[model samples]
Target chain A: MRDAVRVWVLPAGAGPDELARYRAVLDPAERARAARLAADGLRDRFTVAHGALRVPGGRATGASPAALTWRRGRYGKPALTGPWRGLHTSLSYSGDLVAVALSEGRPVGVDIQHVVPGGDPVSASARFFHPREARHVAAGCDQAVRARRFVRLWARKEAAVKAAGGRLWPNLGMPVDRADVVECADPAGRHRLADVVAPQGCAVAVALAGQEPYAVECRTDLGDFR
Target chain B: MLEHDVPTRDQVVERLTVLLTRMLRPDAPVTEQTQLMDELGLSSSLGLELLLALEDELEIQIDVEELDEDRMATLADLADYITANSTAR
Candidate 1:
């Protein structure tokens, strides 16, 4: 009956050496998963450095980070296996920051972006953005205008799709612009989509399914792991 | 799908400007051409929030298709679209 979403913000400042040190602490299973992620060009050092902090924040009770096994679907999205059932989680990295969100009984997705002035949000939108979203970005006259709106919309859509447990392909037929709040009715049931604004310079969002009051807990500290 | 009477061009612009000012950070100065994201730092979710707010305040339904990038690039564009399309009921 507790439906609160817990969000943990991990400092991104950990360097390569620091990440390696963290990796040494991981149990065999987590180390293997970290290796797989690294094989995919997801830096092991960064993932370990950040993932180490996020894994514990879940407060998975008797669970340990290294004991958790991860499985992925065709889209390369990762999920924890074994004892970690019914709990949804997501991870995002931006610069020196790694963010993770946890929700029980609902899929969760999170994204963070550092706003850089005069970035080409329009071009980025066109490549990965939906037609409607692309058109929306195109409306902006300058890079700065387009980029800001582009990233915001991008993060929202990505988080929604991620929460739904698959890429947004055939489902794109649905008009995203019409719904202020969207619910993804997967075979597993309904998932709620919501957005959260991180401290300025950062944008974040969460998707939760089921009938539960939405609550978010965010922290900028990673000192708990040390 | 909007049900309220169409607002005047100036009225729409004024109202939208006020909303933008409030939603965006105090330091961010929104202009007629200010892009919702770049200038105002609004994400897509916030954009939807703005859209919903406008719909609620204006008592009109804004078709998602109508709110394309070109029409939503500036406050002037959004205001114009609202004024031109709002119902006259």
Candidate 2:
């Protein structure tokens, strides 16, 4: 009950000047990561995400936005380092939204996904998700609801994996629909997951690493990108 | 589905490239070395769609039990595994 995760939702859409401002704060490594993306849209989102994600991390650690340093964990999860090493953070970008969750000591992972209209989630769930999860997804009344459930379950799994800094493939079959807080063995930890409020058509979930209850503080700061 | 001869590795690679291009609509050419998840932004669900599509396109069955980061990182890596593991469906 003592843990608290502060999450910030930022708009991923940026104009040329806005993109330049975000890129200006990025370190050389972040710039290189963004450059490797081929598509302009993908590259722009990456730039904005990495730059904007640092805001909450800096604020939590009392460091300047430009002073936060990030390095990839063994599994490619972005981790705070240097002066901000004590603060834990994770980020996810979906469509036009980027969500970042930060906590003082508990490693946090946040996922925001834009559910595609008319995409088939049943087959995807059957093929990839846990048996119980697949059944839960299929239980949805219609395709629309099924897709929403599919992405929600997916966000939970991904957020959990990100919290443990574990790989996603092996944990795909982890049954998350059973309860909000599930015991997972692959990560060897308890994942407390909650669905955060998001824009319509977007599914958002945040995972905190522990069995104890925690509070999620959500902040919307679209103005940061502008 | 009709049974057919197992496609050679090169044939698999060629068709896989076409499939990747059509599916991804990528900015650059989808090469054998292209990173599927990173460059293409392939989600786990989309990744399944791809494997299913590949099975239908090639008329083969891929033993997905072996599918992991080691084999799914790039087009070439996937093609190699598919060539070895697939059977006429």
Candidate 3:
């Protein structure tokens, strides 16, 4: 079978009952990690529900969650450690939404941002955005125009650096202004990255360094799994 | 070969002042002695952005190593370096 990258987008309404169904599949340590996150209030039922959705697709082998260890590089970027060498995965959460990215042979990163009209575009652009990007935002002629452009740029750059598998500083050398749709050639190989727009003025970007065209599956029904 | 006059130091400084004022939103004049970080609070990311802008605007390749804090102390200093280096090329 050909290895394929899968992206899963969980809807805003996913809840606890949906998460309970996957408990049986999780190894003891994975369960423990979920419990810890829940206790700390860093996550709740919805977080666990989406995390469960990612479990089977992670391609994790063995009986223990410890088998799914991750190694951290210099800048604290994390990667899976094991026989799953080239496989890449990442998960992101905002408000009630959760998104995950998986690829067979290259690092993958994904980001989603909800557009807030009349937001502070300049400050956001100044902190995480490229200089030319800030100029683009500033030239938008009005508030709504600037806010939309700012979120698009923010999502694109964050996803790109995450897939680059290093510190954000190293990727600074790459031209983010020309990054609208990039096909980056790195030491590992070439990879494609593109942005996706979600309904309700949301911006999403996904980065994949694999052979196939990227596909995104948006799931609004976690109850079906239950 | 046709001769093209190199950009004068004053011209380079003038362009850089506008770029810096627009990007950094600083009120004071950008001078040779004005420290970029101390005066304008140009973070590392912004410094990289300035380098990229200089590269694209002037069509010059800036060595990353040359942009250390000491060399990039002021707007005029950066403009001077970019003009000198690009003209030499």
Candidate 4:
């Protein structure tokens, strides 16, 4: 049987009083990382993202949000350390959204980007994206359309690389197929990538192994947890 | 590839040193033995950005996989790789 992938989205910003409640769930190391950030907004985002990670992560592992610990890989990919076996996870945040992806039996990564206008999508694509992706983004009829396309492609690659535990630098030149569903090669194996339909103004994606028709269960109403 | 000559080791080193200093660490010592990640705290995105700059400056295309941990360990290693891969000046 194929494993299912779950994506949870939480609001990125929080008031100071609420931020403290979320901050309570993080370990000392996470708290330290949050504290080290120079900007209060960035600090709040880090606290909430890390804290939100615990909710789905704990649910999948049957551990409390505060009880979960993380061990980073050689490439610095964070993984659950203790008894939460068999669950793979990834997280990403952009602008107003923090997304967490969880899967069983396969590694997973999620990426979401808020598409801002006036940024040179074609030029940005040429610099950072694979030649094929650059061409694809440029093929869009207009600037706004192209920018949106570029973000989708960018999110796909980011999510795939995160899932593969691969470096983004090398994979920047790695070509992904034009189809919505594509596969990216990693040292370990190939990972399946998919474009996620996200809320307006954002592009989201999830990457994992296997070809099964996995369902994406998304929840935006995570206010109670915070 | 014929349009531009492969830069010499010293040339590559000099250019890389300047690039790293400007983009990654300013007013810091950059040597062949300097670790990109451990010493400079460069993230994967930044590492890729560096690679892209090198490609642009050198007029060469380097596969991202080629810049694995071993190849990107230090400044000299990348210089050697770039010199070997680039068209001979």
Chain B alone, TM-score of each model?
Answer: 0.75, 0.89, 0.71, 0.78
Weakest ten-residue segment in model 4 chain A by summed lDDT: A179-188
Please give the C-alpha DockQ score of model 4: 0.15
| Candidate 4 segments exceeding 4 Å error | B1-89
Least well predicted 10-residue stretch by lDDT in candidate 1 chain B: B37-46
Give a tens-digit lDDT track for model 2, residues B33-56.
Answer: 898866876666567677777777
**Model 1 misses residue A71 by how many Å?**
2.0
Q: How close to the true structure is residue A77 of candidate 3, measured as C-alpha lDDT?
A: 52
Clash statistics: count for each candidate = 16, 0, 0, 2
Which numbered prediction scores highest in lDDT against the true structure?
A: 2
lDDT of 3: 0.57
Q: Write the per-residue lDDT of candidate 4 for residues A72-172, one digit (tens) a residue.
A: 77666787776775788898887678888888878888998877665677866797677888888999999889978877877888888788877665676
User: Per-residue lDDT tens digits of candidate 3, residues A62-107?
Assistant: 3243245566665445677767656677665544455667666667
Q: CA shift at B41, candidate 2, in angstroms?
A: 3.1
- What TM-score does prediction 4 earn? 0.74
Q: What is the TM-score of chain A alone in each candidate?
A: 0.73, 0.92, 0.71, 0.91
Clashing pairs in 2: none
Q: Fraction of native Cα contacts kept in each candidate?
A: 0.00, 0.31, 0.00, 0.13
Residues A68-181 of candidate 1 have per-residue lDDT tens digits of 566775554567676676776787665455677776666677776656664556544554456787788889887766766665665666566677665443233333444536
Angstrom error at residue A210, model 1: 4.5
* Model 1 chain A worst lDDT window (10 residues): A36-45
Which window of ten consecutive residues has the lowest lDDT sum in model 2 chain A? A54-63
Superior by DockQ: candidate 3 or candidate 4: 4
- Each candidate's interface RMSD: 14.0, 2.8, 14.1, 6.0
Pick by TM-score: 1 or 2, better one: 2
In model 1, the runs with Cα more than 4 Å from the true position are A15-21, A25-45, A48-50, A116-119, A123-132, A140-142, A168-180, A183-190, A210-213, B1-89
